[model samples]
Target: MAKGKGKTKGNGRSKQSPQNPPPPSQCETLEEDEIIRCGEPAADGPRCKVHQAQYRTLYAKYKAAGKVVDETKAGMEMPSKEHIAQYSNLHSTLEKARRIRKYLEAIRVEKAGRDMHQKRFFAKADDGHKIRLKVLEKQMSAAVEILDAVQARAFDLHMADDPAREWVKNFQAAPLSTNDEEFFSAINSLESETDPQRDIMKQQRVAAAATTNDDTMDADLIDIEMRAKKASLLYVFEFVTSEEATLQCMREFLGPENANIGAKSSLSYHTLCQYYRRIVMHDPVLSLKAINKRRMHVQFEVLMDKRMDFGLLLWKDSIIEAMAITRSKAGTAANVGDPKNRFKVLGGWVFNTPHSGTMSNETWGTLLETLAPIEANIENRFVRLCNTFDDLITYLSFGALGLFPPPRFCSKTDAQGRDAVAPRNHLSLCGCSVNYNFLYLGHHPLRDEAGPQGASYGLKWRNGLTYLELFEMSPMHLQMHSYPDSGQDLIYFQVVLYSDTDSKDKFECFGSGNEALPAIQTRTFEGPPASVTNLPSGRGEWEVQLSASDLLFGTKQPEPGYLTLLTRPGSSGWFFHFKKMPVKYFVILDTVPHRHHSILAKHVAWTALCTHGFGEGEYSNRKYARASDVMFQKRAEELLSWKPKGSWTATKMGD
Candidate 1:
């Protein structure tokens, strides 16, 4: 074997191999000097004959100076696998630090002692250093204890015991006249459940703050004082900014993906509206709900809602719960079948493959352009489109029916060329979740109907269709081939149909026209959910409310460390366990989203290479997952090893 491309990734060597050559068709935010691109028009091209000497001179000059040097020299550079790995590790550490900092700031946890932690601590005491240091140490001690069994406060190297151990003493709750239990409860929950030392400190303060004559502390007055003293406008500002940053991250990362191209514009525009709509909320960062109607396009809506952990006080709590579900048995599986058919035909939305986060906007755009309904290049584009269609269906479910009132403002009637989100009635009510448009076919009666007669018509529509009969349907022969063999091959699918309302029997639906279609084994547990009363129906939408847990995490048991959360947010403040991140960080992600898997590949690979005790600065191709492709297979678990693919030498998992 030619020592495949990954073998020499990080030995401080660089060669032009297809795998490691300049990343193709993707957008990257990089320091100007660190990028290397291939194939551009001479004038537009980098390092071409016309600009070679100048390019070399500029590069050499920049390198000698040791800075980003310039910003205009475009395209990403190729680094030795070692360099990439090292940089990735640094980034991961910084990210964790950032997350921790945000958590502290959210809860008013800051460094107490002289310049110890950053100024972002909980409260400012006259004995500031002592009080803050104690709090920091207490939290650190708790975390370190979880890392092992030792409950010793001195378990951490950074957190040393100070003579002033009594400082982390006063987290408390005063009565609120507003009776907004949520806000008050949120504060008390964290305060009461903290370490005993912290609790004891609080009690001592309460006794001191108490009036000797009254014998009761004026908690309300004291609480108001604390709010005024501890409240930060900058914190609120950054919260909104971070939300926008996150939305932009998804838009720039996931929007270009093939998996999201289905209601491409709808999702994007909806999210855009949300972003602008929230431009001036609570403290004015985002409360601008009225956006220009024209700007709210379908594709833009795709970026709107994401993780609700944004401004939450219990950010760690929510994610920890989600982590449990993801790490549990049911989160992992190998169900690589046709994704689109899996959602529509099989009526299930579970993923089974590790994502390779490849963050390439240009490449995904090329793919999106390729998938466009042009008269010429339909076949080539549809192949990739069909394979990733399951992800698209998931998007429709979470974004369309899962949220209400539309993600954005779209009041105009139908037009000639412009496209928007389908009328809500066009949505699908699958076994449990709601979807839009049948993923398997474009054919439907009058575009929207949930009535029994419409259901009967739907049966008739597919009854004689040949494409419905096969387990595997080729995208190329979609309309050309007739029923039976025309239905393609559906042997890989498994579909179930739940009623609009409840009942004991959940009816099983298949790709019409044949028995060969994959069978979605019906369940005795989940009765028919979407039951209908009217035999004739019009365009009325369906909505389903999901628990925070359901969207935040997946089920546990039967499969440990297996999570299949993968959906695009369709509205504001949306939070669904997303697919395409690592098993360690996030449980839900694309089995083969977009090119959605690309983000997973890049980030996970980045984290693994940088963290996990890997050698100094070595990265592997295996660490870099591509959102455009599904990469899980035999020995796939080995990819979890911390070292770069080229340098790793360890016993694989599940051996």
Candidate 2:
């Protein structure tokens, strides 16, 4: 009986009754007062497991919030610290609640997944289950309340703490008046507050945008008045000298400077030539003949000879000053426009002379009469100035003489001389290289005095794909530009070279031998005209050399002539000139192919060939503003061996 009693008690059966007493209030809810905050289930003991877990979580969050408030309060002032501490505590509490809510939600998800996997979706849970879920709901509710309180507190604190933030926060939310006038007034106040110069800045921005398209930005508003003067040929001379390192190099190579040039001494042509030959093997007289046509177009040999030299000895300084003034004009002046107030010399001196274009016998006589009485550094100044001009030529020429002229062709005996070359059978497919973009034969009325009344054409070479070829062709283009302008109704199309012996510039028009009449044949065109009374006109492509020879000798026998445009005779005149025409290109051409040669060297040679044809001998056929070529050549030749000082050297240039 005793064992049975003990066993029953151990089994938790009531001692008084054998039947179960409604399970002895299995849930604490049945025994606890309705007023108790949590109705714990008896299975979970005196504490409600769900509510107990929530209490622990809330207590932990409260402790963490208190700690954070304490730490933040350590660095603040009394008033601010108090206020912020309160807010911080509230924020931490709210954060803790959020974490608890998330944890409970995760628990719910785990329960749901377990129930689904176990197929217990329809299983009935006891009051304990209900209480657990209810506790979670209550926790979420409390967390939300704390969150709301925290946010309200933080907002109040922020409003009192940060004015700028507060202003930004309320700006958009501030109410506007319903009245139109009040509304506009409020808007204006806000606008001014945001930007004091709102209207002005807006106007400025609009104006600036408008000016973006103004052309003035691309142009200079102030005009720069130009003083007419020549570009210093000294630079060109320097380039040539630099290429050969003329003076210093020669001095080093020859062991000593030629006392004749290095020191102030009267230098004759032969002596100067010797000095130059010894230095860099250059000759000034020959160099003058080469580039004289375009620069210093005067006979140096004749002017410097004996009696002429005597005349210069009397008026050398004046001539030097005159030449210096002329060079300063850089080809801008049509003629020496009244030499007075025109030329500036060393020592701030000024003088006058005859117009450069009127350098005739009459002008020379007048200049001599005016300058003979005046005394100056006649010999020294003249030599110095002439040397300067020579230096320019030598540098520009790059220390070289003329190229080999084609051998002369004797058709009668089929013998060729070193002076000239005949065309190997004139090909119908002849093509001349040009350096222009396009050739245009445009016409403008004479009544319209808008500059030149001539055609503008280009000489662009084709299919060379090289800069050297382009450079070689530039002279040709310059020649075309330099050619004499065809007068009104007169177009000088084809430039032909004839013997000076031909009185009328006439030749056989047709036929190969005696039967042939005067005619112009090119790579593409042929015409003397059906009748002699017609202006040449028609589209035709012709091959012509853009070279020195072409400039010196026109389309003549032995040497090949340039191909050109022509017109038929007896037709409605193409250009409408009622007389014969003289066609010429001021620049010369070399028939030898330069594509395989050094362009720089070739240009140097070319520069040493063309001269102003005032007379016969190479040097005597020209005019010079300074002293003799002898002095000039001496200086130029010295420059050939010139070396840069120290270790520094010059960077070379090309054209």
> Per-residue lDDT of 1-655 in model 2, one digit per residue for the tens?
6565635435554465655455433323211112333333433443345433332333344334434433433442222333434655535544543554454344333333222212311224567655655654554344334433344444444335533334323331321112323433443443354233434543344434343221222311111000000111122122122323234333443456454233111112112222121111011222212221322221122211222333342243333334433345341222334433232211122223322231222223223333344232122222221222222222122211111121112111212221101111100001111211111101112112222223323234222111100112212211111133311111111122222224533431111232211121223222222332442343344433233333233453333223221123342221212212222222222223222212222232222222222112222212221112332343334433332234122221110
| CA-lDDT, candidates in order | 0.26, 0.28
* Over 4 Å off, model 1: 1-181, 187-631, 634-654
Question: Which stretches of candidate 2 lie above 4 Å from their native place?
Answer: 1-254, 263-338, 345-655
Q: What lDDT does model 2 reach?
A: 0.28
Looking at model 2, residue 225 earns an lDDT score of 6
TM-score of each: 0.19, 0.16
Candidate 2 TM-score to native = 0.16
lDDT of 1 by residue, 1-655 (tens): 5556656556554666776765433221111122443343333233234233333333343233222211211222222334422332333434433443333332222221122112211123367546644654564443322212111111111112522122111100111111222434444554655467545645554544433322122222223223332332112122223434334434544565434443333333232222332221111101011112222111111111121213111121122222223344663212322343211101112221122223122222223332232232112212222223333232232222222233221212223432223222122111011211112112222123322221222343433211111111111000111122211222222222222122413223233343212211111111112344411122222222111112223243221111122233332221123322111111112122112222322333333223323312433444322210121221122222322354323222123
The ten-residue window of minimal lDDT in model 1 covers 473-482
How well does model 1 score by local distance difference test?
0.26
Best by TM-score: 1
